[model samples]
Target chain A: MANLSALMLARDLKLLLEERSKAVAYTSSQTHSSLAKGLGILGFHPSQIRKVTCDDSMRIGTALLRSAIEQDKALGKTPFLIVGKAGTTNTSTVDLFIELAAIAREQNLWLHADGAYGASALLCQSRRAILCGIELCDCLSWDAHKWLFQTYGCGMVLVRHRQFLTESFGTTAEYTQDAAETGESLPNFWSYGPELTRPARAMKLWFSFQLLGLNTIDIAINRGFELAETAQSSLEGLKDWEILSPAQMGIILFPFHPHVPAANLDEVNMRISQSAIENNLAATLTTRVRGVLVLRIYSIHPNLSDDEMLAIINGLDQLAHLYLSRASKDDII
Target chain B: MANLSALMLARDLKLLLEERSKAVAYTSSQTHSSLAKGLGILGFHPSQIRKVTCDDSMRIGTALLRSAIEQDKALGKTPFLIVGKAGTTNTSTVDLFIELAAIAREQNLWLHADGAYGASALLCQSRRAILCGIELCDCLSWDAHKWLFQTYGCGMVLVRHRQFLTESFGTTAEYTQDAAETGESLPNFWSYGPELTRPARAMKLWFSFQLLGLNTIDIAINRGFELAETAQSSLEGLKDWEILSPAQMGIILFPFHPHVPAANLDEVNMRISQSAIENNLAATLTTRVRGVLVLRIYSIHPNLSDDEMLAIINGLDQLAHLYLSRASKDDII
Candidate 1:
């Protein structure tokens, strides 16, 4: 067992020394699994890479790559990334793609951008800037799930150098071959991945992408963004808590004022959202910020309306007033 | 940045400490994302983990937990898991749920199996062993996007520990609502997770699960297992390659025969897998035996029949013969 670990470690070191490391996992600290995997598959130790973030609970993967490249001389290592959405889960933050692409070119690194969540934002005119340099990336990823409103596991990794994926992920066994080593354009994607007999998971994504088309996605993106915008404005300074990050797309993060007592801000935000979710109401929560705790509500569900957003804001206002009153009484005591 | 890493590290340490951690994440090992994430989210440095393998990938996870208990002696710190099946990518590597449940009970750990790939096996009579202890699991995770044939991001996390999830992951805000300390019967899951206004990925999975019931799933599992069994028997006693682990449900791993000239089983298996994938076949490669390097396959599609598996096996057998012939000639020369 020690020998196995040693051999594995040695081979990894050899890859490091030989600099044959071809794939770079570009993940924002925000991305859950997509970015971490690029490096994991390429045989990297977790600490050997960087997962950069932009805001609280978001990652600026593009910026991190640029930083890696800019500091490559000092740090002595180049970075390849499987970049993804910056502030996802809440579908909020996004990385600086244009800058990351430029760094990819300068550093000769493979750039795999993951827009699985926010890339759905590409359909929107306002949010399109967030993905300005996507085409320039060596690879791109997006989820038919999440904002795409498709099935889960409908996440895909699109490599600009499709051949690289073929090189890294593809494989074949002649015994399993339907035919000989002849010249035919057989998809044999089985060779380009690490799994055999893969589920036809792509069909749903393809179906939904075609079914809804760009207009629907764009509208969804716009609506979610609009809701966040309205909620942010309506709830601003209307409470004891403060809003931290404003609505980027369809997310808002703020916390109950930190100086307050063990205020169950987490509990309160949950109640308002629960009031909505349980009654089949429309809303969601993302994460806590500034130790104050926050909520994020963003989506493209037709059920979510402007009125719902307004109600959400009203609920926040009411909660804020109650919290402030409670805090005041606590202060008096 | 150091602080963030420190916090992540601290969180991981707490997960490994003698105290039970919160919001356990149990998934099958075949889902590479879950494999990559086990320690990262738990807040460990990642080194302390040594993956468990059950000759098949199923054992790696169980082994890891056993290692934690026997090696680390952090028995009281219950670990979270996510098992997989229907979307395991490796169809045959369905988790030994009964064994895992036993382990979970013994260690006070939370079991969240990711049956995203192999879960389709649940519908089978012979493969019923895979799902034996499934109901006992604290949580069940599966990707509808895979075999149930949904689209991407169709992953579902089903919790048996309904109350625990609320306690572990519930949150809210006063600015959102105070609820008057009122009676909120059910808590919103948005707070129980790390997302806000999450996409309606649930609808797709819900639709499929409700529509299909278990009968539909059983047929697919039976069919896939048949294909795998056919493929394994056809390739038995091949010249250079041998089945390292034959299919139980759909996953198969075979290493190079010890006497084969391309002795580095990992390298040879990798090369064969790489070549096969480039040809656009329905296959790929992975390293579950870690350093052992074997050709692994997962047959999961209900659309595929046993004959298809035969065609694949024939192709592999031919390749092994060709390789052996070449080696013999080289030795003579």
Candidate 2:
């Protein structure tokens, strides 16, 4: 919902400035899929989203993004927005926001950061450097439900300029005139978003902050990084597990290859994931990293102990061996 | 939010059918302002909305709507959706939905009914006739927070064909592939709407219905009509007051104009409303009925007694007399 609002604001800004409805936005293939879906909902064609290639580290390829913008402009498409990821969903890779911010400034585009999964890292001073350039974004969307220890349905969108929200979503009606702003005070919140009668979503976050001091909150966030690193180190000790993406922002990906063909590796990893769930070991899942299907572990629970993480890894290794033996027997048959 | 989703579905349906981005929608001037705001958020220009004038009773003018559609079509605009009000906010006037449904069928347009305030009346067999043609709507947005005795932030949008929702909002990502449907059962709810992670909003409504059976719920809704009629009867006995809109669907509108000029009528009624709030008499507000600023009463509380309703009306009468005398004294000076 936060990303949807940001794209709406960007689209409205382009309409206001260039009076162009055929506007295009730039985001890497590594960015969250919700951004493309939001653009489609906002009346932009699928072709309007330029999925620029990503680097080997899974970060957005900055050169490809620049060239895509230039090409779109040459083709008479208005380039209006650049979406950068503070921490992507799949591999938790942070995009090159500094370079993207420079391009946004040069091209007069809105820079929006999808910080839903990783913005909570900003609470921990030591881990904040990875998202250094996030401050330069025109807007940032953060989800408290992800890493902020909140229940579901809590997300926030922060814009550099407050007026853009009112410009994009301000509403008035005869029944609501009594509650209208008098110009001496802030406008009613209905003007700032799509909802006219929404719950006080910030109250939960406020209560959480008041209950848990910043020091404790920062430690909780830092624990996520510690857990991810523990999972990476434990996986490195395994025989045939190849780390597809190293632990970053509480997410790590790996697959057990064991000199198997590429086609069999996906099947093997998938069966291992299914076995773990079936055996009630861990509720793990598989995701495609680069072109290979890999087991992805998102270990962000502050209460998750290091021993529990190691047990889950070892259990998955055993399941992989069991599944590989079955596959070999089938091949022999 | 429900209306916003309906407009998005309508927009996407238009895109699928005609491949036209310049689609126009029809709604009455008395329709909720949120419709226009939602269209703006969906990238439709303000001019794309044709606010057809309303009749004297505040119902949508059907002839004018037909002419407007014809005019837009002549100008090469794609008319794709028509919004009809089940019960307007100010006067609680329902539009000619039968006429609207017929027109939509003939024009091949999507018909949406804004039943946020009045859909709950469907529980009462006595009041259900007012919303007779609501079932013919391609989609209907109903808010349980109003008229249904639920707390705020409970709304539901029902589409005639469930497939339209999936076509408009179905989304998939690598991280969510494991949860994808295998085509033999129902799809995950994320495919049906913008939210991927939403609270179970239906639980509250379900609980209410379970606790208070349909018969009790029906009586509670019937009390809304009884309370409005009580207020209307009390206002009719008082001097210097005229009913702008009669009691209908739990709403009534009137102005306290005791031979006052048209210019002072708005000022006098507004002051009366303000005094009602200041004196803690009632939280009454004013709305324009046929361009006349009038006191609008939305009385749907089942527990409110007829005596209490009479007392509030008498209290507003006293405040209006006090404000009018003071204004006359100032005029003499």
Candidate with the greatest lDDT versus the true structure: 2
Instruction: Name the weakest run of 10 consecutive residues (lDDT summed) in model 2 chain B.
Output: B13-22
lDDT of each: 0.53, 0.87
- What are the chain B TM-scores of all models? 0.71, 0.95
TM-score (C-alpha, index-matched) for candidate 2: 0.96
True contacts kept of 1: 0.00
Native contacts conserved, per model: 0.00, 0.71
Error of 1 at B27 (Å): 25
Q: Report lDDT (Cα) of residue A1, candidate 2.
A: 83
lDDT tens digits by residue: candidate 1, A278-308 = 5554445535543444666654554577787
What would the per-residue lDDT of candidate 2 be over residues A236-281, giving only the tens digit for each residue?
9888998888999899988887877766778788888889999999
The pairs that clash in candidate 2 are none
Measured against the true structure, the TM-scores of the candidates, in listed sequence, are 0.50, 0.96
Evaluate candidate 1 by giving its C-alpha RMSD to the native, one decimal: 12.3
Clashes of each: 105, 0
What is the per-residue lDDT of model 2 for residues B1-333, given as tens digits with 9 covering 90 to 100? 899889899888865533445688999888888899878777777888888988877777889988988988898888999999999988888898999999999899989999998888889998899998989999999999998888877888999888888888888888887888777376788888887777777789999999999999999999999998999999999999998889998899988878777777888888889999999999889888667788988999999999999999999999988888888888921
